[model samples]
Target: MLAVLLVTSCTSSSASGEQGDDAKPRSTSSARPAPPRKPVALTIAPGDRAAGVEPGAPVTIAAVDGKVTQVLVVNEAGQPVAGVLSPDATTWQTTEPLGFGKTYTATATGRGTDGKDATVTSVFSTAAPRVKADLSMNPLDGQVVGVGQPLAFYFDAPVANKAAAQQAIQVHSEPAAEGAFYWYSDKEVHWRPKEYWAAGTRITINASIYGRDFGNGVYGNDSRTAVVTVGDAVVANADGATHQMTVTVNGAVVRTIPISMGKPGHETPVGTYVVMSEHTDYTMDSSTYGVPADAANGYRTTVAVASRMSNSGIFYHSAPWSVGDQGHRNVSHGCINMTTENARWLQSISNKGDVIVVQNSGGPVLESWDGLGDWQVPWDQWAAGGKK
Candidate 1:
């Protein structure tokens, strides 16, 4: 009877401790927190954002969540430049040649693959500068121009590569004069023969640039060549002492005119000057060239056929005031004063680039010194600045 009572008590304790089926802890489902969403931010610098950066140029990109995992650069036409990646992957660089004045774009993409953040996209630009340039002749087949003219090439942009440009530029003539280019500046270039080109000679210039790069993704497009037929060389001699000038064409004296030169102290230059311009009835004001117009310090007159020799105020024009001294004596400022008929004749004989030599003068040579700019520098000195 005691054992049966103990067994009944143990069974009751087990029943109370064991939870009922309905009282079991409810297993409610809670949604797992969605993965953190990616933030959107893409920032690039060097606002002219593109590709084809200069050698050793710096490129930087900014993004949120450090999502910038990749960057790409394409050319102006949306072509990729080769080897545009650094080993560290911090920057994008180009090992190949980038053109000049070209356009490109850099793209950056970031992904939240770590599953802790979001993705991002960024775009930037970098440009290479036009350092070395080549100026070749257009019309590879070749054409012809005036006999007196050289193969003239006007650069579309300033060139930093003087030697390359010079090397790429070639001149072919029936009889080569061993031509050389004289760079007036990054903007202007002039080529000439060791001497004046042979009259009636055919000259050609070839500017070959197909795969060549000028920097800034500005690749030289098609090759070009300019052809010209050389004309008779015109040479004029203006003697200040004799108060006379002799004009020659193709080694023949075509015209001679009596003229008045500058006075003893204010003489004209004695050297070779090119006929830069021509005009009829040009005003002569001392004030324009820093000469006062007072009777004691100025010269005021209206001359004809104002052919400019230099940037100075000197010219070969009609001088009615010095008619008495014309062809006989040298008296006046630094100018060649002639009669209206002689001045007109000079116009007929003179051509652009025609030589005008003034001899036996006491004053300075009217060599484009005042406003001539870089052209005033001697040829040898001018070409010395070129980078090989």
Candidate 2:
């Protein structure tokens, strides 16, 4: 009867959900809470630790899922590189440019949401080119050029990657002028507006080519800058049929001058020309254009005022010898000869880039690449970014 009573008591305790001997206790610590989250992870770029990175490109360290505390980049010589940190403290970047083909180390630290700390380190290197080409440009700083002047650049080496090299240059003009670049050769380029620059336009050109790749294992060695201002517009129109020349300054007819152009056999080139230079007292030599000094059409003389218009020895100079035929006929070799007074006036008001338009001259069109003859190319052809 006692055994029956014990079994019945055990069954009663099970039904009431009461703990019994040999039964596990219902403690509150049965399932432990999940462990705290891990700290933020660090990532560094230039994925491979090799010598193929651009020195100017940003070397960045970034953290994810948390916030970064600090970052440091140092060269092989233990020099600390200058860098800028983000406002959110999640990223850092090196500001000071790195040296080519040099080793560098980047170390970053971050903290997790649950107060845990983490750190990461990376090693990388920059590119080293076989040749570092430098750049030079025209329309130098502080010079006042004419409205038709083009900003020219001459690379020290031929650029195989012409597109990349062209893109590295930035040109900005005050009052905004639309322009494009044209390549005369592999190493020479020029930039010009669709039309002549307005009077008083200011232009600044910057070549940010340092550490940039220019193809064929060549890179840029340095940067360059040029600032130029456009002065007044001086345009001269000479007509072979009328035997007259009219000059304009900033859209107004400034003066009219009687002139004698090249004779029938040696008519002046019938196209646009730019005045390359001017001189007060200059020598005129027909031999310079391949004519013999003692030949029938060749003569050597001095002029009081001469303005050079072409590389092939074209000029407009004071010719007291031709003054009698100036307003009536064309009787010079291949130059536009005018009175001394008119030549001096033309020289005084003209800049290096001034324009001279010759009409009905019965000669071949002026060839581009002839003494600042950039205006000969059509805009569509120029905008094609030649040799790219």
Candidate 3:
């Protein structure tokens, strides 16, 4: 019995040794902890909150050491918006449009291989359209005007409330001259002292047209400024009876040209006009003025060196065909008929602000076509024409 017990014990010992020898080697006794979590960073570009920006702006967020798991933008209500996560889990992005004129918040989260997690957040606001008026003055703020020059302002949108817009506009100068703003149209406004600006006087304009609704849905952009130096005044007088138009620089006669007045029916107007525009070889026709051509009332077309006399169809234009009647006869419809060479001469000497006076003619006045001239209406009157 003792021998049998000894054999069983030996068999048990041998089995235990075989199992120990077949086992794999163990380099580490326990599993390693995951890498430390990465730090998350969120960045917002264009820090301005008042600038008008459209939706779907691009945004990005990233983690330094770990993988980015998620990134999202939310409104005040904390709703999830469009966002993205990088393949390496180290970055996130929002690729969708955002709401305008609203505040938004962004959040980013990341996880590292070390079984650690990280998170970050940021806030920003979008631009919203506000109510108010802004005016932008041209020729630069605090500029000087040369002699016989006028101050002008341009509006981006057509104004229905010309009176309101004009009322908000003001001008200041060293001599404190009386100036008036005339609405040429919904988009253009010009200010002129009763006469030309005083020489060496500093002039300024204050315009507040922002956020104020012009007709339709348009609004003013912002306030603007302008300053200029005034120089010597120049004038030009044209007499239909004498068939002579004289140009005076600083009240001195510099140039004189023999001119022909308009014909009986289509007479040139009598008025004070500035040198509005000058061109060579301008086309003239009664059709442009809405006058139909027929046997009695209609007329054929004519071309000349067209110097625009008024917003109306009148021009100190070239009429080579009327040269024979220049000094002795009124042969043109309403233009100050001149030779091409003479018109070219005038064009060389004329400028935008020079004045022209047409006298002794049975025709419309400057104000007759002032509507076409559109630049003469007062600012108060212009504001009254707005929709609101």
Candidate number achieving the greatest lDDT relative to the actual structure: 2
TM-score of each: 0.55, 0.79, 0.53
TM-score, prediction 3: 0.53
lDDT of 3 by residue, 39-156 (tens): 4443434232424433334556766656677666788888877766667665666666566466777766666655566766667765454433344454465443344456656665
lDDT of each: 0.60, 0.84, 0.62
Cα lDDT of candidate 1 equals 0.60
Best by TM-score: 2
Candidate 1's displacement at residue 168, Å, is 4.9
User: Tens-digit lDDT track for model 2 on 1-388?
Assistant: 1122211222224767766675543433224455556668778875546567888677888878778898888899999999888998888888877899899988888887767788888888889889899988877888888888888788888888888777888899987999999999888888899999999998988888888888887888888888888889999999988899999999999998999988888988888888888888798988898998889878889999999888888899999999999978999887899999999888888888888998887878888788778888889998886655
How many collisions per candidate? 28, 0, 47
lDDT of 1 by residue, 323-357 (tens): 99998988877878888888887777555556677
Which pairs clash inside model 2?
A: none
